[model samples]
Target: IVIGSGDLAAGIADQLRAHPDIGYDVVGIVPETPDPEEGAVSLGEVEDLPRLVREHRVSDILFVGAGHPDRVLGTLLVKLADAPVTIRVLTDLESITLSQGVAEEFLNLPMLRFERRNLVHLRPWLKRVADFLAAAALLVVTFPVQAVLIVAGLLARPALAWEERHDYRGYPHRIPLFHDPGTGWRGALFRALPPLRYLPSLWPILTGALSFVGPYPEEPDENRAMEDWNLILTRLKPGVLDVTSIADHPWVPFRDPAGLNMYYLQHWSIGLDLQIVLKESLRVWDKEEGESRHG
Candidate 1:
């Protein structure tokens, strides 16, 4: 559905409706004026918006025209706060992404989103399920190596160390790891096998407290949860591997965790997660191989 109907609404609606491949099905419109153009699927005037949205089950809402806060726009935003619909406004303005709103192209027209929804989405759950299975499989394959490490830790007398991290919703997560192997061939071997440090995290994945790919967990910090993007990251469990840490080109200058994490959340899918996992394994192998050759 679209708000502020006129030429802007009609043009955008027609373009999206014409292109089936674009995946936008404009079901109806909500003009600010009572008199919308003739023959358009005008649901009703501005006052009737909330009712129309709930009645028609609108998944997305596009507000036409310049995004200056008009009385109608201001009221509509507050009213629709609890509604589970994605909202965007058509704008040619420069991007103000990465903070409160995100800018993106909607059928070639620049659109701005004023809100970030931490709502329950099926894709996130699908991601969790996929991570859970991958973790299970890795644990099974590396059982022998894990057993050997456990035995070594036992004999070395500094078996395990517990570290504190925060998980979803600022819940405390106690992570267990084999203590430092020390400055010897044993330590070199441990460094060569970076994944050894993360084997304990596999169980959390099985328990749905971690993912195979997502935003890397930050150490306990009260301020992190208060930031806009960081607040969004709390929507899901931290991951065993940060996607860009493995998939991003080494020469790229942009490496801010907030920006990279926001990008990951915006474009995540099961296929993307699998691709990241494959790249992560290969990258780790390459690193270990290069280090071993030099060391």
Candidate 2:
């Protein structure tokens, strides 16, 4: 069961609904009215979250809400401390890293289930919805800013700004503006407004070349070099944003990278994916914002 009736809640419900082995059911409870979507039903207000869990025999509960996820999550934890319901919390807030105090109380109930979560029955459908809304919102908000940045960068550093250069074999590679490089404008625009990076990959995602959330795609040669490690990371499609990319970890050894991805895959869930995506979006956005300011 998932609590809260916001997008995150809906996304989680979508994941649970997709997992066949889990045999999961979702109950969305909001302070106001709720909409019944897929296998989920409205369970009234936040006060009724525990009751819904009990009634539905829910083995797991994911918290997907808007505004101050930690605060909302803390409240739910306090309320359900003695309710015998395992809970998961989702958030985009970067301030309050999950505290050990809270994690101890909840016993870290919302475990990440990277791979298994993908096996979920409703995941494909739910991910499509979440991707659509997220990409649409991003495009709407950033397109203009991106266009301005592109024009400015093209005029200022028409030679493909030194920093914007892509390096292959550790050598700087720049495509000229005089000749239309199909990827030039769009690439510069995305690099300037990194939030739209996902826009380019949306089609690949829909076509199964990508997963809703996973490792960022490595360059082909780099990908091939890690034949051994590929055993680990190759199982999933590259996500536009992911743990390694978000964490800004350099030297992503072979495949395991200190077994982070392995652990991530083992404990991945829709909530975890939400957390990672949000974190990555911030990192990417900030990097671009910094570049824009400097440029």
Candidate 3:
């Protein structure tokens, strides 16, 4: 059954009607509309998906809506989990490739079967091991520099800045970082040291609330306003560093921030995490070198 009644859904129906050899019937659209296209039936609202599936003897479902998948695809899956139906999701090419969805080209139109799977399900323990080790090592190595910066900041400013941010699971936690409360050059100098800003983030990683490499933390308000796909990202631990900063360099190709995080979620592995860490370290070193030479 076609799950939408918009232009894309109508277009797909038109193409399917033209291709007789494809051997598939055009089922009615869902989320009952007052104005369905010519010769198309309107099934009940999305909440009645299961009943419609049974009544129509639906063998397949094509979700062609441009709405967020959490509301569109998620609602359908919850009701039709046990139903025998082949579901195809229409999404962008990047999401299709990252998700490992089966790709098809019909009349030069890209089609992908949307079967969502947790990419890191099999290696949670391994990821925890890596997070613990990396967090511990970073804390040890950076403690002296952090101490010096803390002392200096305390002497110049009344208090250090502590930002309250939400993690992947929407849990609130305070992260310590240097913020210039417009206290002149001393506060500016404190903010210039990137290592000092990330020292307190090690606590979350050590305590198992975060990973050494994962999605960046979002503010509570920002997290609430995110789209369905971005909300999925909050399921993974937030990291101190993100791929976006590294990818932002002139030499590195620009990537969509959300797409890059989604890519990491779908293709996560211990080895991939290590590679990202190494690249991030190098990027930081190059940045520091350029700053020293220029500043």
Candidate No. with top TM-score = 1
Q: Which ten residues in a row have the lowest lDDT in candidate 3?
A: 245-254
Name the candidate that leads on lDDT. Answer: 1
In the predicted model 1, the residue pairs found to clash are none
- Which has the better lDDT: candidate 2, or candidate 3? 3
- Candidate 2, residue 133: the lDDT equals 63
Q: If scored against the real structure, what TM-score would every candidate get?
A: 0.48, 0.33, 0.45
Flag regions of model 2 displaced more than 4 Å.
1-192, 216-233, 245-258
Give the alpha carbon lDDT tens digit for every residue of 1-295 in model 2.
5556544455445655555455665554453234456224566666666666677766677665555456556666887777777766654332222321232333656443233223222233555566566656665675675466556556755523212222211223222222123356655656655654344344444455444475434454643465333455555545544555423222211122323454454345567677777777787789777976897
lDDT of each: 0.65, 0.50, 0.64
- Candidates arranged by lDDT, highest first: 1, 3, 2
Worst 10 residues of 2 by lDDT: 161-170
For residue 107, give model 3's deviation from the true position in Å: 18
How far off is residue 180 in model 1, in Å? Answer: 4.5
